[model samples]
Target: MTGEGIKECELIEWHIKEGDVVAEFDRICEVQSDKAAVEITSRYAGTVRRLCHEPGAMVQVGEALLEVEVADEPEEEEDAAAASALGPMPPVQQLAPAEQAVKREQAGLAATLASPAVRRVAREHGVDLASVQGTGPSGRIYKEDVLRLVEAASEEVPGPSLQHKLPEQRAEQLSRPAPSAAGLPAAAEDVIIPLRGYARTMVRSMTAAGAVPHFHYCDELDAGPLLAARALLASDPALGGARLTFLPFVLKALTVALAEFPVLNSSLSADGKALLQHAAHNIGVAMATPTGLVVPNVKAVQGRSVAGVAAELARLQAAAAAGRLGPEDLAGGTLTVSNIGAIGGTYASPLVNPPEVAIVALGRVREVVRPAPGGGFMTASVLAASWGADHRVVDGATLARFSNVWKALLEEPRRLLLHLR
Candidate 1:
C-alpha cells in the first residue's frame, strides 16, 4: 500500500494497525500529493503482518507499508511454466528461495549504498547495480564500480565508439543496505522532501506573506552615473581593483532611507496584533544554492561605509557559496533583498521575509536610449526594482517613496558618494 503526502513529499503514512487484516484493494494508507493526499490500496488480501510507518512520519514511495500473510497454494505445472516464460532466466533464477533472501539483502543494500548523486549517475548510465562489484568500505557498491564497469565494457568492445547513456536514465545496478560511516539506517526508497532548508522556509514565508495583503511598487531607474562611478573606482589602482556592485550602493541608500520609514523594517508579532520594531538594520541577502535557499544577514547595516558593506558582502557570499555559514548568519534580519537580475530575471514580486514588513528584488540593468534635450539620443543603463510590502505595516504611498529614494540615489552616483558618512 502507498501512503500519500504524509510528511513533506515522497513520504507515505500508514493509517491502520500493523496486524489488522485487510481485503484485496482495501485502502490501508495515504500518500502525499502535489496538491492533496491520496489513499493507497492494498494489492493482496491477507492478515496484516507488519506496519512500516507510524502516524505523522514520512516513508518513501513504493516502500512496503505493511506486510501480509497470504494463504499459500500449490503451484501448478502450467502456472510455473508461465512464470518462467515471463522473465529472463537470470531474473527467474533469482526467485529461488535462497536467492530470494539474497535479493532482499541486495535490495536493502542498493537502497543504502549509493549517495543521491551516485544513484542519479547510475540511473542515467543504465548500469545494472546488482552486477557491479562493491569496492566501497564494507562491501558497498560505490560510484567507482559503475565507472569501472563502463571502462571494462568499453575496452571489451573495439570500435569507433561504444554507445552509452547518461547515469540517470540507466537502471540501478547496486545492492541494498550498505552501511554508512555513521551507521544510520539506510533509505530503502526514493522519498523526496520539500520541507528541507530554504524550501521549507519558503513555504512558511509564502503562507505568511500571502496572508498579509501585499502591495508592490515598481520603477525604472537610470544608472548611467552609477556605472561610470563603478568604472572609475574599478580602474583606480589605489582601491585594490575590487569590483563594485550595485548592491552596496543600494544597501547604503536603503539603510539611510529606513530611518524615515521605520515601519517597513519592522515585523508583525506571532499573535498578529503588535508590531515589533527594532533599531538595528540587519539586512538579509537571499542566496540560492543547490541544496535549497538560505538568507544570510549582515549585522548593523546602518552605520557601515560603502567599503565596509562590500567587504562584508564578499565574505558572506564566499561563506554561502562554500556552505560554511552558521545558523546565526541566517537569523535577525529586519529587511531583505533578493537579486534576480544576476540570474537574468527582470522584476519579480519577491515574498517578504517575515516577520519583516518588506522585501526588495533587483532586476537586471541594461542599456536603453532616451530622447535628449537637443533631439539626439543618449544611452543610459536602466535598472528595474520591485518592492513587496506588508499592507499591515506599510501602505502604497510609503512603498512608492522608498522606490523613489532608491532611484534618486543610484542616478546621482556622486551624490551617493558624497552622502556616505
Candidate 2:
C-alpha cells in the first residue's frame, strides 16, 4: 500500500506482509498522526498479492498501497457478455458525465481512475467501475463512488452470487469446523468471537465486572442550576473556546464527593472479601465506539481545572473515536462515569466497571418547569444520574450520602471549584 507522508525521520509500520490472506476490515498498517499512531484497515477480503510501496515509505491518498487478487468470475462473465454484444470491444476509456454519479464515470483517464482499494471493493460487489462518475479532484474517481455504486446496484440486482455458487460448495464451507485452540480439544460446536480493538477490551472488562455483586441506584437531579452555570461560564472571556457541559462539572463534583466517600472510590479485592482504597483519584469515562463500549480513564482529574478537564476530555474522546487508546488509558480507574445522554437515553443503570467500586451514568437533560419559590414557574434542564454500587462493599446509606454530596457540589459549582483547588 502507499504511504504518502512517510519521511526519513517519520516512520510507518505495515502489520501484514505481502501474500497474507486477510479478512475484510483487518488492520493492515499504522501511521503516526500528530498525537499518536493510527491504524488503517483493509477495505475488502482477499489474498494480498503485492505491496505497491515499501513499509516506512511515504504515500498519497489515491496512490496504490498494495494489490489483492480477489475472485472475479462475476465481473469476468459481465465483461464477456459486454464484449459479445458490443463487438470488437472498444478499448477501455474515460468519460465525463453531466453530474457526479457512480456507474456513469470514466476508466481510461489516469486522473479519473479508481485506486486499488476502491477497485477491489467495486469488484467484490460487482460494481461496474466505468458507470461511476468521478467527483474527486479534477474529476477523479473516488472511494465514495464505489460505495454509491454498490448501494444502488444492491437495490436493482438482488443475489448475483447465489446463482454462481453450487449448493454443495456452500454447505461444505459452512459445515467445516474451525481449528481448535492450541493444546485444546475442539467442541461439538464452537462460536468464536475474534478479539479486535474495542471488542477485545469489552470482553476483558465484562468478564472481570461479572465477578462483583452489583446494585443499582438511579435518581433524577435538577440540572437547572448546572445548565445556568455552563451558560455563565461560556459567556466569560477567560473561558473562551470552553463549551461547558454537565460532565466536567459532574466530574469535579464527583471527585470531591469521592474524596469524602472513600469507600465509593475504592475497588473490591479479587478474592471478593476486601476493599482496595486508592490514594489517587482517577476517573474513567465510558465512551461508545464503533465496535463496543470502552471506558478509558483520566488520571488524577481532581488536580485539573475546568479547562484542563475539557482539553483532556477532547483528547480522550478523539482517541476513543479513532481506536488509538493504550492499555494504561484503560487501567487504574477508581470510578467510572457513563454519559448515555449523547445517545438520547434518559437513564441507564450502568454495570460496575471491574475493580472500581462504582459506575455513574449521566442521562439526557430535558426542559422541565418546576414551581418557582417567588412566582409561577421556571424552566430548567432535568437530568438523571444512575449509580451502580458493589453491594458487597458499599451500603445504601453510603451511596445516598455520596449522591447528596455530588448534588450539593453540582448545584453550586463555584463551591465545587474551591474544593477542587
Candidate 3:
C-alpha cells in the first residue's frame, strides 16, 4: 500500500499465489495507482495463505491484501540465496554464445508467470513473454526481464524483406478500419469509472490552483547559446555520461534569478498580510506520467551545479516514470518549471501550483527569422517562455524583471559557468 493521498488502487496482478513461499522484501504483487504501477513487496518472510482480492479489484489503502503464514527466520546461507535470487540475471553479453542459446531454450520450457505490468511492457515492445526467463520467486517474469529482451532485440539487425514489410504495405494494412463491435454494448454505458487515485487528486489540486489570484507573463529568448552549451556538456566524457538538457539550464538560471528577486519565490501568508520567503530553492519539474501530472522537485537547487542538477533531474524523471515516487518526492516544491517544449508546444500559460508563488513554462526551441544586429534577416533558435505567478505575492513588474534575468542568463549561457556551485 502507498500513502494516504492515494485512496485506492487497482490490484493489476499477483506475482505470488497461495502456498507460494516468499522472502522478506520479495515482490508479491503489482498495483496500478493513478500515478504508476507499484510493486508490493512482502514485509514478512512467509508462505501466502490467502488472497483477499483478485486481479482488477479496487482496493483501499490499509486494507488487507492477503494473509501470509509467517515463516521462521532463515539461516545465513539460505538468506543469501534468497537475496541473490531477487536481482535480475546477468545480461546476454555476459554469457557464452553457446550458453546463451541453451538458456533461451530453457526459458521457453519454463512456465511464465508475469504480472500485468510485465505483460504490458512485453506488448509495447512486441516481445513474447513466453520466451523470457523469470528471475523472480516461483519463476515469475518481472518488468526488467521483458526490458532486457527488448534491449537485446533492438541491437540485432533486421534480417530481410520477409522480416519487415515495405512502407506502402504497412500503410495499407493500418488504413483498414477496425472491426465493428455490433453485438456488444458501449463500455461507458456498462461501467461507471469513478475518479480515484491520481485522477482524483489532480482535480483537487487544479481546482485550488484555479482559485489563486494569478497573472501571466510571456517572452521569447535566443536559445542558440543554451543549445550549444548542452551539446558541449553532453559530449564531455569527463562528466561520465551525464546528459545535459535545456531544462537543467533553465533551472540553474531560475535559481540565480530567484536569489536576486526573492519576492518571486516567496509565498503569501494565509492572512494575505505577510510573505514567506524560503531559504532553499526546491524547484519542481512538472512531469506527465502514465498515471497523471506529477511535479516532483529536486531539493536545494541553489546549492547544485548545472551537472548536478541534470543528474538529479534524470533521477527524478526515472522515478516518476516507474511510479516509484514517494510522498517526500511530491512535497516541498517552492516553484515549478513545465517543459512543454518536449511535446511540441510553442507556448503555454501554465497554472501556478498552490502554496508556490510561481510556475514557468518552457516552449519548443525553433528557428525564427529576425533582423540581424548589423545586416538583413538572420535565422536563430528561439524558445517561447511563459510565467504564471500569484498576484498577491508577485506583481507584473517583479515578474518582468525576474523573467529578464532568466532570459539574459539563457541567452549568454557562459555566465552560468561563473555562478555554478
lDDT of 3 by residue, 309-337 (tens): 88888889998887778667777889999
Q: Report the lDDT tens digits of candidate 1 across residue range 1-421.
A: 2122323333345656766877777777755422223466666666665553455444433333444666463333212211210111121221444554476586664324443445555675666676676553234445667778878887887752314544332233233345658967756755334364346667777786787778888888887787777776755554344456878778888887788778877988888789978898999988886546778888888878776777788888877776556555777899999988989877888888778889999999988889988899988788888889988779899889877876787788666665565
Q: What is the lDDT of candidate 2?
A: 0.67
Query: lDDT for each of the candidates?
Result: 0.66, 0.67, 0.76
lDDT of 3 at 100: 51
- Provide the lDDT at 387 for model 3: 94
Best by TM-score: 3
For residues 187-246, write the lDDT of model 2, one tens digit per residue.
563333434445655776778778778888888788878888887786566545655677
* CA displacement after TM-score superposition, residue 293 of candidate 3 (Å): 1.4
RMSD (Å) per prediction: 18.7, 17.4, 15.5
Model 3 stretches with alpha carbons more than 4 Å out: 4-15, 23-27, 30-46, 69-191
- The reply for model 2, stretches above 4 Å from the true place, is 1-28, 31-195, 235-242, 374-377
Alpha carbon deviation, residue 384, candidate 3 (Å): 0.4
